[model samples]
Target: DMNDIPPVFTTVPRPITLDDDVPIGTTVINLVAQDSDGTSPNNQ
Candidate 1:
């Protein structure tokens, strides 16, 4: 639909406190985005 909404962040990462000695390549958090449209391309 032309009025289709944009993808939203279904899973947002939370703030975290890391030590100064933490590894440089350490992963902080993960995020997820989802589209409500039920059609192809748009759903991706």
Candidate 2:
């Protein structure tokens, strides 16, 4: 019944090195997150 806990990021993106030639709108890194409340949607 204690589902008031807030969502937290389980894993975050680390420092990344990109080339100067990198194009725009390119994904640099991906972030991962999760929620403990089973009743609430996994909307991290």
lDDT of 1: 0.82
State the lDDT at 3 in candidate 1: 34
lDDT of the candidates, in the order given = 0.82, 0.72
lDDT per residue, candidate 1, 20-42, as tens digits?
99999898787898888888777
Off by over 4 Å in 1: 1-6, 35-44
For model 1, what is the error of residue 14's alpha carbon versus the real structure, in angstroms, after optimal superposition? 1.8
Q: Write the per-residue lDDT of candidate 2 for residues 1-44, one digit (tens) a residue.
A: 35566777778757899999999999888877776766635333
How many times do residue backbones clash in model 1?
Answer: 0
Count of backbone clashes, every candidate in sequence: 0, 0
